[model samples]
Target chain A: MADFLSAYSIQNWLESCPQGYLEDTSYGHAVGEGEPGLLMDNEVLRNDAIRTTVQLVLGERCALAASSGLINAAPDEASKRFLATQTLDEARHVEVFTQRLYDLGVAKDDLESVLSTHANPHLVAFADVLLEKVDKKDFVAGVVGQNIVLEGMAFSVFEMMHAVNSEMNPKFCHVLSGTIADERRHVGFGENRIGSLIKEYPERKAEVEQMQKEMSYHMLATFAAAFQDVEAINELEKIGEERSHAKFQGADLGVMDPDEMEHLLADTVLGEFKTRLGRIGLEYQTPVAP
Target chain B: MIDDVHELRTDEFLAEVHSFEFWFQSIEGYLSDSTWGHDADAEEEAIDDEDRDRLISVLCNYCVGEAAALEAASGMIQIAPDRHSQIFLATQVADEGRHLEVFLHRLAELGVTDADAEIAKRASPSLLVFKDRLLELVSGKDWESALFAQNVVLESLEFVVFRRHAAEADTITSQVLEGVIKDERRHMGFGENELGRRLSRSPKLQQRLRDFRPELDALVLATLKETAHHLELDAEEERVLGKGYLESVERLGLLG
Candidate 1:
C-alpha cells in the first residue's frame, strides 16, 4: 500500500537529493578538498591510487551504461524515472572517479589510455555479464544485474574504500560517501520496484539467478586480482604513516591484510546480493568459488 | 507549438553545455525557486470539468510522446560519439524521464487511472508514427541521423507542444512546462553544436542530412496539424512549427 509513485517522483528526488542528502556538495565531495599531499608526493602511492581509481572509473562507466540502458526497458513510468536518476547518479560516479584519476596525475588526454592500460579483465567480464541483459532489454534481469548485483557490489566496495581512506584521504572519502549513499538508494529501488515484478513473472527467477551466478564469479575474481597487488599496502605499511582505524562491516580495516580485506569485501557483496535477490523473489545461485 | 528560436551561434550556446555536475546545479537552481514542487492537485481547483477532461486527454498524448523521448535519449547514451557526448545524453535521458513523470503525474491527478490505456486511446496517429520513426532511427547505427531525429525533430516538436500549452495552463501545468521548456532548449543547443560541427566537417553528411528532411518534416507537420486540433493552437502556432524547423537546420549550417 505504499505510494510507489510518490516515493520515486522527481519532487521526491529533488527534496531527497540535491536539496537533501547532497546539499552544498560539489562533484559529490566537500568543496575545495583536493587529494591528500601524501598521495601527490609519493610515486608509488600515486600509481597505486591511479590503479584503484581506474577500476572505479571503469566500474562507474559500466554502471552509467547499464542504468541508462535500463530506462527504456523499465516496465513502469516510476521505474523509468528511478532508472533515469540512477543513470545520472552513475554518470556522476564515472565523472567523479575519472576526476580522481586526474587528481592522481592521469592527464585528460591520457584518460582512455590509462583506463585501457589498467582494465581488469575480471571486472570487464563482470560488466559484460550484466550488460548483456541490459542490451537485450530484459528489465527484470537488467535491474537484478544492475541494481541488485552491481549496485550491491558498489555499496560494499565504496564502504570498504571509504573506511580505508578515512584517515589519509578526506577528499576521496567524501566522494565514496556520496556514492555509497547513491548506491543505497539504487539498491532500495531495485528491491522495492522489482519485488512485485518478480512475483508477477515467476518464471524469470531462474534465468536471472543464472546471471547473478555468472556475475558473482567474475566479481569475486575481480576482488582477487585487486588484492593480489599487495605492493601498495606493503609500501604504505613501511611509510609508518597514519593508518585507517575504520571498520568496514565487522572487519577492522586497520588490522586486516589484503587477502583478508578481499575476503571480507567479496563475502559481504555476495551475502547482500543473496539477501536482496531473495527479497525480490529470486533464489541466489551460488557461484563456483573464486 | 513554437517560440522564438534563439539565433545564437555554435560557440555562443555550446559554452553553456557542461558535464552532469553543471546540469544538476541548473536543475537545483530551479528546484530552489519558489514556483517549483507544486502538489499534483495544485491546479485541480482552478480547472473546470470540461477543461479538466481535455487536459487529461491531451496530457495523456504527451505522456506517450515524452516516453518516446525518454527511450530515445536513453538509447543515445550508448551511441553518443564520445565520453562527453555520452555524459550529456545521460543527462538528457534523466530530463526526458522527469518530463514523462511530470506529465503522467499530472494526468493521474486529473482522474486518469490507467495512463497506458489513456495514451492508447487519446494519442493521435500522426504522433504514434512520429514515435515509431524516432525509435527506428535511434535503434540504428547512424548517430547523426538518430540525434537529428531526437534532438532536432522530436525535441523541437515537444518544445512547441510545451510552449503552446503553458501559455494557457494552470499553475501546476505551467510549472511543469517551464522546467521542461528550458531543458528542451539545452537539448537543442547540443544538437546544433554537435551536428553543426559534424556537418561543417562533411559536405556529404550535410547533403545527406538535408536529404533526410522531407519525410520527417512531413511527419512533424502532420503531428502539428493533429495537435492543433486537439490543443486549439491558433494559425500562428501552426506556422511556427515549420519556421522553427527551418531556423534550427539553418543554425546547424545545413541550409546551404
Candidate 2:
C-alpha cells in the first residue's frame, strides 16, 4: 500500500501543479504567447537557457561527428566507458535546464516556439552540423563546430552572467549559483575535449583555428547587441534607480559600452589562450579583426 | 580535482583560460623539439624554475591520452578473438602507446608533477566510443564480418577527419596532431586494405556491406551535416572537403 502511494505521488503532484505563475509573482508567470506555463519567461535567461540546452542536445551531435573522425583511429573499452559517461553528462545538462524552466513555470508550447526563434539560429545550424549535411561529413570536426563554436560562445556568455549574478542579484542568487557551478563543469569538459581533439588532428589545425576566429567575431557581436537591448537596458537602470531593486544592480551590473564589451570579450579569450601558451613559453598571434 | 579549473573560473574565466595557455605552450615545446633546426636547449636548460616543470606536465597529459587509448584498444583485442584479427588489433594498440611515448618524453624532459587529473578530465568521450564499438564488433559471432565492417566503415570516416586537420593545422597548435596523424594514416591504410582483402576472399562479406550502407550513410550524413553547421564553414566548404577527400580515398581505391 505504501509503495503504491509512493509510485503514484509524482503523477499526482505534476497533475495538480499550477501551470502558470512566475515564481509566485503576478507577472503572469510569463508574458509569453499562447501558453504561459513555460518557466523561462524571463527574456534574457530564456535565451541563455535555450542556448545552454542546445549544448546538451548537441552532445550526441559530437558522437556523430566523432565517429566520422575516428575512421582510421581505434579506441578501447576504458575509453568507451568514458564516452558513455560523457554522453550521460551532456544528457543530464540538457534535462537540468529544461526542468529548471519547467519547474519555474515554462509552458511546453512556449518551449518549442522559443527553440525555433531567431534567438537560436545557431542551435538549428548545430543540428544541421551534427547531421553532417551542411558541408563537412566529418563529425569529429563537427564536435568543435557545435561544441566549440556555438556552445563555447554560449558558455562565455553564461560565465559572464554567473559573475554578474554572484556579485549581485541576491534574490535569484541561489539558483543561479547552482546553475553556474554546472555550467563551469560543462565548460571544463568542453575546453579539455576541444583542446585535445584539435591536438589529435593537427593537419586540420588550421581549419579549427580558422573556425574559432570566425566564431569569435560572431559571438562577441551577438553579446554586444544583447547588452545594448533598449528594454533590458531600461530594466537594468531601473534596478539601480530603485532602492528595492538595487541589490540586483551593482558594481558588476554596470553598463558596458558595445565597443568595450567587444574588446573585452576578445581580450579575455586571447588572454586565456595566451596563458595556456605561456606555461611552455609558446605564444600565438591571435587572428585580428580587419 | 577541478579546484584548479574552479579557481580559474573566478576571475571571470580569465584564470581558466590562463590555465589553458599553460598547457598549450607545453604542447608547443613538446612538438617543437621534433622540428628543431635551431637548438634552444641552452636557454631551456638554464631555466630551473617552474618552466621546466611545465614541460613535463604537458607530456604527462599526452601519456594519459596514450594510456586511455591503449586501454580502449585492449578492449578491442579482447573482443576480436581470432589470431589474425588480434594481431592487427594489438599492433594498433602498440602504435597508440608509441604515439603516447612522444608526449611522455616531452613530459620527463620538462618538469610536470601532476597531469593525471587534468588529462583524465580532458580525454574526450568521442575517443572512448571506439572501444565500445570495437567490443561489440569483436564479440559478435561473425569475426571476419566485424573486422570488415570496422575497417571499411569506421576507420575510413576517421581518416577523413584526421587528414583534414593534419592538412590545415597551424604550426604551434598542430603539434599533437602531427604526431598522431602519421600513425592514423598507416592505421587507415591497414583497415582499408585488410577490409578489401578479406572481401576478395569471401563474397559472404556482401550481406554485411549491403546491410551497413544505410546505417553508414546516415552516420556519414549526420556526421557531415553537424560538422559543417557547428564549424560554421557552410555547405560549400563541406562539399569541397568531401570532394577533395573522396578523390584521395578513391585514388587509394578505398572508395571505389
Best by DockQ: 1
> TM-scores of the first chain across all predictions?
0.96, 0.56
- Fraction of real interface contacts that model 2 preserves: 0.00
DockQ result, candidate 1 = 0.58
Query: How high is each candidate's TM-score?
Result: 0.93, 0.38
Q: What is the lDDT of residue A7 in candidate 2?
A: 23
Report the C-alpha lDDT of model 2 over A75-119, residue by residue, as the tens digit.
Answer: 332222223222222322333344444544556447545444534
* Candidate 2 residue spans exceeding 4 A from truth: A1-76, A122-155, A167-201, A238-251, A273-290, B1-256
Candidate 1 C-alpha lDDT tens digits along A44-64: 989989998999999999999
TM-score of chain B of each: 0.87, 0.53
Tens digit per residue, CA lDDT, model 1, B123-180: 8787888888888887785799988888987888888777878888888888888888
What C-alpha RMSD separates each model from the true structure?
3.9, 21.9
